[model samples]
Target: MIDIKMLIELFVFAGDYNWIGKERAIKMAESTIQYSNPVIPGFHPDPSVCRVGSDFYLVTSSFEYFPGVPIFHSRDLVHWKQIGHCLTRQSQLDLEGCRSSMGIYAPTIRFHNGRFYMITTNVKMFRNFYVWAENPEGPWSDPIWPDWPSVDPSLFFDEDGRVYITGTGGFFGDEPKGIYQAEIDLESGKLLSERRLIWQGTGGKSAEGPHLYRVNGKYFLMIAEGGTEYGHMATIARSDSPYGPFESNPDNPILTHRSTGSSIQATGHADLVQLEDGSWWAVFLGIRPVSVPFSGRHHHLGRETFLAPVTWTEDGWPVIGDGGKIAEKMDASTLPLAVDESAVSETDDFNSNRLQLEWNFLRNPQDEDWSLEERPGYLTLHGSALTLNDIGSPAFVGRRQQHFRCSVSTLMSFDPLHEGEEAGLTVYMNERFHYEIALTCGVEGRRQVIFRRRIGSLWKMELVEDFEGSDIILGLDAEPFQYSFFYSLPNGERKAFGSGECSLVSTEVAGGFTGVFFGLYATGNGKSAKTPASFDWFQYIKS
Candidate 1:
């Protein structure tokens, strides 16, 4: 039943892809040429893309996760490989107390003078900073905090050698709001010009996520508005000069699904680039409703990165999606087919020196609390004072729950000596929204597997059964609105415990800027534990 040669080959490719393994090889056998929506899947949002010769690099918002801003390398735009993160070192960022959707906002990636530049806002922390690296997978330079007076920051190097910054908001009370711009000295990160108001959008609320580009001798300003919800839209304006009293496109709101009732909603915040073939494309963010739609079109996976072709009229303005709609299917491309097996890595063996790129903590983590080499082939997480519901970062590491129909399982060896010690698998949206099936010590040294659900201020926990709490396999299967938990006892008896409404951990219910993350966690309830919890393996498969 097993093909040894194929398995070995798959491992080779997996190592090449960093986090992808057997599942990728199996899926490659069944792979066909189909350009689908959410080209870069999962909870990756606020995509910014740029081209460097035949190579293409794209980065997306990580919000509260770290290392922040996943940087992907793509040769054919359709297939992408996450090479590394822009914020790999602690000196590059600080998200220590960042709550859900409050840390790293949106990032814009561009290339100039043989260097890769990434500029973004760190929300409540670092206001605005830019970093540069010769290679996409860095050793990047430390952040240079620029005095850009906005939230969604972008950099435009003019033909006359002036570098301009464009963004939204009034950073200071007296500064003008809407989309603002200023020229900055790149070396000193100092503003050189007075902040100027560019466009207020086409009268939409919250005109943000702006990108400026020079195409065909015209300066173009593209922005997103309507609050990043169902009413979100993309609009464009252009002028002869970068700092403009620019003219708006009569057919404004160029890219939006509002009022169309399309499955892909809130389609806006796009960045454009021209490929080697001279073909234009855009990478933006969109929310996909679950199979069973709700009154609010509640999405559980959060906003995901989507790819669509962009066409310029003979007049120079950009039009995205097919006939202004992003289609699920498109004609196959002449470029070679590439599949990202790592997007749905079937098994993470925890045998490597570093965690996979997909794994991230709630915020900036205390380096001493987690390790990969302590147990030879396991992830050892020391218990922390913070619990899942606490405001600070807990001893947690998770990957995005990208697909609605999928299963997440882990084998953990944790023996708690006190009622306060606990470790297990969790489906978490934020501090106020999550579900966990954990092994915790009870009265008289008895350890019990418990199911707990936290929604806003209410906390409900149920005892599933008793366990010795060593080398136990815990699992959660999600489908539509339901998520079921299961466990394989040390003696090999399989038991299904219970289920919860998937919406309990959804963005709509949680009221945050993120999606669900299936994570492994160890906690001390309120005190630090005496020993560490070891997880042997983790698996996430999309059905």
Candidate 2:
């Protein structure tokens, strides 16, 4: 059998002279190349990727979620696996009283000298810092606070062994808004040079998310412009030196979907990577918005990470996607496709001593409110005084709703003592905008099942029914436009209870950076409950 490596080597050696060799090689490798967009889907925004040899590592922004900065590992760049998170310990991230979208923002991960560094800003704390680790799935070091005062921090390790930090400027007192850069001491987090305004974008609003790269003996400064909305775009500038009198690309806005009727919108905040095959690809954040009648476009899944191929022009500028645009499906010749089949599981039985990497809390959780070993084979959540309506962290644990059409169900056993005590499934967007189908004790301590919808300040109990059993199965079926709620008994038939409009919890209506989460929650409204809620199993299947 002829080796595939030898065939590729022969094709390269034949160069432009042998068209037959090139065609045969391309045909032989075509099956392992094609992939869809949003390589890492659902609420994973502000993506940053770094390549180490044949392996690729990626990290995304996790706003107001405990265990911030979800890290992923991939070999083909099209398929990704959640290895672990960069900030796992409380000392690394503190989201205690943070608002829905005001915790971690735009983390840039880079590997230098065999060590991995993730730098980002905690908007709630108003600080810029970075954590380091030897391994991507890690026990990362405590954050080393830098003197810089900006969001979306990125580090560039130069060939001269010097390090430069770049970020969105003008957040400091009286500084003009633009992309800013400064040389820094990596070990001590001290500034080695004065902060300088590098390049004001090409007359776009809110020029931010800066990253610097040296390619073909010239420094390229790339940034996102146009306010991270429908008009969002990625632009680039080139200069002879790092601190530059730079020239913008003649065809600016390297990537965008603005002013178009495409399904994907808000495309920007991109990071570039050069693969081992010397091909260039970019990872950017874009939202897939579903058009609703009388409501324009609404995206409930938040900004997702998208991949696009990059090609260079004769004049030394990079053109992204197809003439500054990308679709839901993309065709590219990538590394041999490798997928981690066990990365995302469809069902979690709650039998392990610890929760999986996909599970995340709204904020820093109180240890006494949740337990995995208390019931041996179930997840027990003690009803906390902090309800989901409050801005505090309640007894809740959730994972991102990754698909537009999916089914999520959980088997819960709870015995409520007070009228306000409730425990069950929640399709949560934020405190003010969510849908909950819970098992609670109604007035006179009567067992009941209630479906409530909270839209801003208006709260309504849409469905209520008396229940007689201690164990119930709660389920949520999500479509592009609506979410249907259901409940059932063990090994029994399912009954539809109510439904909620998906547009109500979308970023267009709710006004947040996060997506919807299907969670299990236990709350006592205003006081602590005497009973605990136990969840036997949870299943999420993408339909």
Candidate 3:
């Protein structure tokens, strides 16, 4: 509790670390960003960017996390604040049974005329849809389901006001082969043309995430290939007409790390944006791997959003980064390092009427099951019937475990009347893989703190200790491979538990497309609870 404010205090007083007074603490908080490359960090992958006026907006895929598709706004294109979510309403998306990496796929955001349009595929719903808002910050329209069912859908608006939706579709035997496009009646979400394959993408596997654009009167088609892993790549094609007969760039993949010994890998699924000064940029997804490569080099942080410079060749083909590679350090003149410190805060005060955009539920949550205003300050999560491992939506809300070496702690209070009722912190990967430390009813009507891990088919309580109180500050400090759990009383010393391997809840082990999430949960073990478990505050500090 000595420094519970966490790294946020660093940014708050970073400018004046030699603080003379408390008032200066508030004033100097807007210190310039001091982050390395991959401008936006942790699990924010499949980036699609667009610029309207001087402001640049980016959206990333949020698989299985309700409040799907996070919309980030950046003035300098380097620093970003999540303005809102494109799919905020239940009518907009339903991820009730979505497994990890199986909800929203790649989304492309565009601003045309007066409205901002965001289109993507809801894999769980098996539909490609788009939502529009006059203001990018939202009150966005509900899901507009286009008739076509495909992943990685992109919307293009032509100069003559015609519209098209391009995506990874059409099957070659069992595998979905090539990129497809179809003219669409934007107003009614009706297909105006038959869905047709446009480009197969330089003979790479899984040609997908097609974004159509017009540069200098020629239509440019950008796509992702090689299946979003170490072999991932960014490829392009160009055509004279809106719908093509497009020819692949001879220098096919415009960007990729591929066989390079570099740590950043899986570079593809990109979106392009042009600045007012005519500077070109590409926002794509990539990952920084740890030391070990096989079972050990797990990317617990998931695919992150990266910014790279794009230089168009004399013949009009684009070259990403310096030479078809993702640079670890981005140049200053290009992005300028200016960031709003609020975009990536280490702490959430939960002082607003609504939950912050950073908080996400396991699935489409029952609206009344959780609240911020219900308790004025603390987040009150009423216990739900589902458990953490259940396919049904649990009363669990969490944020992406953004860093491998970070500490997340929460102040929680819950009184369990039955033996199964519990509430505490959880490191959730998916329904089949997760770990939790909870305060629950134990033997002899005594309250106890417990540790439960559900990995693969095994589900068991690992440890239990009797507790005399309801309120406990639960903490977990994570490293790349290991994480230690701890609990502290309101006035007592912090108690540390045995450390666990980070791989237990990883993509390599859990077999999913998402990273880990540090979140708060309340559950009655498939039954309702008498009262709600309240989380006073949560802290996320990069270690």
Candidate 4:
């Protein structure tokens, strides 16, 4: 038997300085704090963070998912809590018919004049807009369309109360592609000056994600380059004025993992923030490849948010991470560790009236498709005509597969009345790449469990087993290399159904900007089913 109390004491002694003394706490604060990289894991990418006093708030891109631009709040930069989404209303984010990884792109969150502003591009709409809220956890205002026609728009408020909009300048055919800047009226969203090409990045393709900061009385213009792939990088240029002949830093490409054998790759699109203690830190995006045998690189978790310390050289240039490189684990001087207990829950019994912050729909979901109050303590999904193979919205609710090794289980009560109706679990990347373990009605209306996979144009029903009950537990175990699916009855022995290669739904094979989502779904192939599926509970636990 283990000494449980002794183990608890040892764990507290390791982290809680109050258990020791104030003197030791001071020494511990001075010492480096070791933390894991990709701080906000899973499909979260294109991170932008801002500090309001001791509290830090961050936002990330949400592509075609409804309620776009998920926002997070943190006390210490290491631990984060999802507060709410910026684009909650359909008027703010209309993702209808939007393709995967093509809706919202590269949102920048900033606090100015007692208001929090979030600016980004809706690539599908070919427009740049912003929203403002009095509180970070918001009832954010509707989109205020800016006159600028570009992507990755960032707002810079100068000391003279002048507002400047800096962004990529490639949407229009006549303008030369690079970083563009112009003065703007913050209230009216009107351009006050002509947009000017600031600095073409150091001969890197796709010089975008522009951010302008006034540091040390100098305007520092930083942008992401190299197309946000293996060659992605963050570069900086400085000048006395916001727009002009800016001098590129002697050490350009301030942060990147290109051409490196490190596990973290595609690092760029970073935002800088100065802590209350006067320390500088950067929040960026990077991807971790699965440690499996594959022809080329494969990452199923998508680009995730990462943190690194930023130190300035004597020459006033910024040094990021370690020599423009970062690792999975980072040791740095940081704020005291603070964990938010309400950040997320591993299990959901569908006890609440509304869905939790972790849950997201494929796109703009139809109100008639899903319900929590219909069958109290259960999530009821009325199967729609749309299937997973369609680009349109379907009856599905999913959360990001945050951990490489984890287990997801759901108790579903569904009896398909028609042959095409299916209700069960899925490991979904997009319409073209996904794997499913579903309960359906087979020939002569015999209840069965089927395992299906869709890789590009290939669709195959790999496994099938006879099942008796309408209520069954469907589960998926995710490993570094594969996902094993299983099923069981209530209080009954579990049975292994089938498995699928993890790389099949990876970004390398699927070729998308999004990652895999462990989801519960219901569909009728091409026609709406008369039956509905009800999930009693859903659980996700990391191993």
TM-score of 1: 0.91
Off by over 4 Å in 1: 1-33, 291-295, 334-344
RMSD of each: 7.2, 3.9, 6.7, 3.5
* Segments in model 4 whose C-alpha atoms lie over 4 Å from true places: 1-32, 340-343
Flag clash pairs in model 2: none
The residue-by-residue lDDT of candidate 1 on 1-543, one tens digit each, is 123345446665775786666566545533434577787777888999998878889999988888989999987677788889999877887887776788888999989898999999998574999999999999789999986757989999898889899889865777655898899898889999988898888889889999999888989999998888888888999999898888998878778998887788889989998877777888899998764454555788989888888887777778897756786665434333444433536899999999988899888888778999999799999889999898787999999888879988888999788877889999899998899998888778788888888889998886557776477888999997899998886569768877888877777778978888999999988899876899999999898
Using lDDT as the yardstick, the better of models 1 and 3 is 1
lDDT of 4 by residue, 239-321 (tens): 99999689999998899999999999999999999999998899999999866653777899889999998999899998789
Ranking by TM-score: 2, 4, 1, 3
lDDT of 4: 0.90
Per-residue error at 154 for model 3, in Å?
Answer: 0.8
TM-score of each model, paired residue for residue: 0.91, 0.95, 0.90, 0.95
**Alpha-carbon lDDT of model 1:** 0.84
lDDT tens string, model 2, 1-543?
123455566665665476557666556555334577788889999999999998999999999998899999888788888989999888888888899899999999999999999999999988999999999999899999999988889999999999999998787678898888999999999999999989999999999899999999999999999987899999999999999988999999999999999988989989999988898989999999999998799999989999998999999999899988998877754555564443477899998999999999988999999999999889999988898899988999999998999999999999997888999999889999999999999899999999999999999999999999889999989999999999999889999999999999999999989999999999888988789999999999999
